[model samples]
Target: MHLANAPSARRFTGKSNRQARTLAATLVMLLGLSQLAPSVHAQEGLAGSVKRGGVIRYGHFQEPACLFGGWVQQWYLQRQYSDNLVARNEDGKILPWLAESWTISDDKKVYTFEIKPNVKFTDGSALDAQAIADNINGWLSNDPDLRNPTAAPYLGESFESARAIAPLRLEVKLKVPFQPLLNVFAQSSQGILSPSALKRGLAVNCENPVGSGPFIVDKWHHGREVTFRRNPEYNSAPATARHQGPAYVDGISWKFLPDQTVRYGSLIAGETDAIYDIPAVAWKDANFRFPVLRHLTGDPPLRLALYTARPPFDDVLVRRAFAYSTDRKAAVDTSFLGSLPSRATVR
Candidate 1:
């Protein structure tokens, strides 16, 4: 997806001139990195320091993720390194990406996409209408009993069939009119992959991905790091803010640093350029010295999935009692530093 402006551009100034000055300085640093850093240079300056050419280590709170595990994180990672037909904005609006534009039939059951021309996968394979159809078919093959189980919940409302109409066009027939079908196409699972890549097997392709995103996977050393480089064949320049060419950073290194303390230390010591999932305690230090971007949960309040189909959680009374007896406030205070607000839910 094309970021209209760098993250630094959205800074909010306050009545406090001192705070504004600090934020302005940090924004300058971020802009410098996003501008002066060449597309081939591995090392990028950040926060007014010359950091080394190395991976930006990350500390995930769970076990190593399966690349094709059909999980949200996996999907997120895939989408990060791949492109979808449609893209979603922060406001949940649909925007065109691979598919430049689309039209829906009067009945809303038939959707036609005008595919972008001259798009090529990292593997040098031509990304045409057939390639998109093949990728969808591959996703459909995952279920034993269903024709398109991978797309069931998403396309079930409208999807009847998908077909490639021409070299740069494709059509989908739906069972009914689904207003949010474009939103479904924007999902990561619906990300388009090359036909040849799928033939090599999902597990194998995960280790070595080939996509039309701004970056392409170069190396993935299981538990160590995953390296990515710009896709020279990427043709989404018109849709992105950096319309001149590919990403500013020549490459990106993602190190698997499990220790939060060490990760924070690395960022502070200039050993790493940036770190994700920063803990609450680290926020104070980061605010004072470094640029920090905290992702606070918003309304619709990020849902948590529970196995209600199982025995223990199957009982309604038990669920209600668990909800009533749970010390949510204490849990939030202890775990999330009371930063997370409480929300009312019904059993």
Candidate 2:
């Protein structure tokens, strides 16, 4: 992938284009030298020769996204292959990613983001402010009259205009001063993509997607599996745990196995490293010893959607009574094996 030099109006304050190129060249030379050495530590591994390589196979309990599923699938694919301008951590805090920093106008109707420099798409396309603006335009094009909408209603009018301030800075004008506009920007649906990827078409390239994330799509077997390899050009890394330099694993393979029984069985047999939607009965297996991570499925406190504008939900008293009488904890215990706790309202 190639990245053009940042325009004068861009806000990135790091090394200039020439300086970055020099550093990259120097690093390449050092890497080549290290490869010739017998004991040199590669960045791929934490210890030893550091020439780590392995494929992480995961089991899925439902049909792959191409066959069925909607935004959730799109969200997962984006997370796997792309980085967002902002990221919402497990604690619900939004942090910067593709955007080095940002600001809001006094009226909060305008938000301007300073994009990072030297970012590139897997397809060898430059990822610039104009590309981001174009992606936003794409979302805006389909936001209205969407048959199946995401959780956020503000997205319907998320932007008035997305303008390129420079090659690496974009200014977005919102129709109204929405308080949670930044959160909407951080949503996976709003993840940035190269102009070429959008032009090539989303559905045609859904399985073999491309982005500027830590990993790149290596191969995709439709309805069977998808594989990803570490991105050698990933510059902006998250301040998270374990991962440093390059990705810890060499590659990852996502296997599509719709049968929950087969998925769990494969996990138990050590054929797969992870499996989604564990069965309730399998939780009690004392011998099973793998980390299980769970999170609030829906946006903040609400898991179930309530159509307050509709008939039964239109009555305030009835809604409140339903919220009160419903034993959320009991339902969670019986349904999700006590993995999730119920919250009172949608946050």
Candidate 3:
């Protein structure tokens, strides 16, 4: 796929996509998706005098069982109510969030993070080193209710334990070198939750998982939607964040519309301010109306899965021919997320 403003064609993979999506969601909440608080028509009509403190109704495709979980959709809600140990930039570089600074051992197994002081969860619990340690251990635990499936592969067998060396220092011990440790910590699934709220158990916590983010999960109306209110005392934004205070919007009504057409339609009809994913068919059209925020997830440009054990794929020459024949630019142009204009048929 070809990304960026006038870029080269390259292979693409969906890996680390959750991070980009989380960033996109964060962008919506933070920047208010470029004055995201107001209605589309209101912002357009009012111009410079942008309205403030209006609840944004966002449309999405899927709804997870709870707020925080392994599924990509779950990560969406998690990002709203949670803050990670660290943050990542547009260029895929790691930045400080809850952790102000860190040092790595020569072996790279132990990561000592300096937790930012005075950070607190919406539930009025302090987010200290011990709090982060509890979150880390929760991710590595055997309990399904707490274990972060998104972080499981990165932690693996080598992840030993997370301990509080001091009130503001956290020591994460690993059995082997895991270079992607910091990057993985930035994922939404790894977002730090309040230990106090977690103690209430999954049944209650899933609907109202506490975090130190910009917003708080107010209530979930079953299969229909989930509502979020701005965290009034919020102050712990990542180093990369532009707005360090509460979210500009009053609250968010995140609606679940599984059908792609219906979801995009909601955005068009002025019922929703934003949607999870822009549909491929509506990509070209949606850009004309809304300020479509495209996130260039810095992974491989493309990744092709070949069942090489069978038939044509089994032959190396056939695989080589297939690679060369792929219309990379056209592939990018035709997809919803791609930068170029759609012209060619999807492969």
Candidate 4:
């Protein structure tokens, strides 16, 4: 689809900041979809019976930039070792995770969060408000040599500073009243850390990472795979968490499989429990057992671009004709091998 913003085609209209923000949020929700498939326990007809002890073998196409620091574009991988202050439910509602509760000021420029107590990082350091403040300060720092390069984009102009007002309370001040700041807090990029590790600096965390997440980084075999062991002491699952108490699996090993064919082969051969971004051919293959797939439409995909300044595309009538002539369903079936959700369910 052509997203033309030319003066003649589509002019910019002034909107109240709040209204604009609401519109942007609505668009974001309509664009994204998330899905996860979990392994079923052997026990039947049990409500709270969670069988634990096996390591979940997972396959990914790419390796994360840093074990603890850098952000991965994909959601299925980044969350293994990081725990954000908050989490988002299936309906896009924000819920508390590391922080037990939070309060916003009348002007909405300030946020005070009461962090959950007794939480410890993988390195056995307490996860207090001080550690969270340090993370924010590091992200929003102006020093070229002391800032987290991956976190700069999210900090932007909205974030002012995050400080610890109490041992378990954090106050975050923003430049403007941004409603999406809550959502941003729930993202993997805002994962909390151990204060001691932050003192050790970012480099050590990259290799020997520490977080208040469900898993701990046990080993990293460079380009091959990363091994994680479940945190036995973890009991602070979010309200929206799928399972109660500790993780169902004993641990998870994320294997890097750049080749789709090899990944699919591993899955079929019982070498791996699950895989990500399987090729279209393998996705449609009937031979695969217990296969699962999820499609993400978190942004308006670029299909065909038409320059409005050009002769044919400049005419509104020509554009309308092209849009009417295009079969979107057929395009979805052909281009994505019917793996993509229909436009109506894109949200």
Best by TM-score: 3
Report the Cα lDDT for candidate 2: 0.55
| lDDT at position 104, candidate 3 | 97
lDDT of 3 by residue, 217-306 (tens): 889999999998888877788876655666666787888899978887776666666676666676657666555555434333343367
**Model 4, residue 208: displacement in angstroms?**
2.8
What is residue 288's positional error in candidate 2, in angstroms?
A: 4.1
Candidate 3, pairs of clashing residues: 11-301, 11-302, 12-300, 12-301, 12-302, 12-303, 32-36
Residues 88-192 of candidate 2 have per-residue lDDT tens digits of 554667667678788989999888899888888878898888887877666656543211245235656655888899998999897888887777766665666
Error of 1 at 54 (Å): 8.1
Candidates ranked, most accurate by TM-score first: 3, 4, 1, 2
Better of 1 and 4 by lDDT: 4
| lDDT of candidates 1 onward, in order | 0.54, 0.55, 0.70, 0.61
Every model's TM-score: 0.71, 0.70, 0.78, 0.77
Better of 1 and 4 by TM-score: 4
List the candidates ranked by lDDT, beginning with the highest.
3, 4, 2, 1
Per-model root-mean-square deviation over C-alphas:
8.4, 13.3, 6.9, 10.7
Full-model lDDT, candidate 1: 0.54
The residue-by-residue lDDT of candidate 4 on 1-347, one tens digit each, is 35321111100111123211111111111122111112222121122243456766666677776665445433334466557788787578998888899999999999999999988887887788988888778767875323655567766678888999999999999898888887877766567767677666556766666776667778888888888777777755665654535555667777898897887677667676656665666556622344232434244453447777988889988888877776656665565565555352110
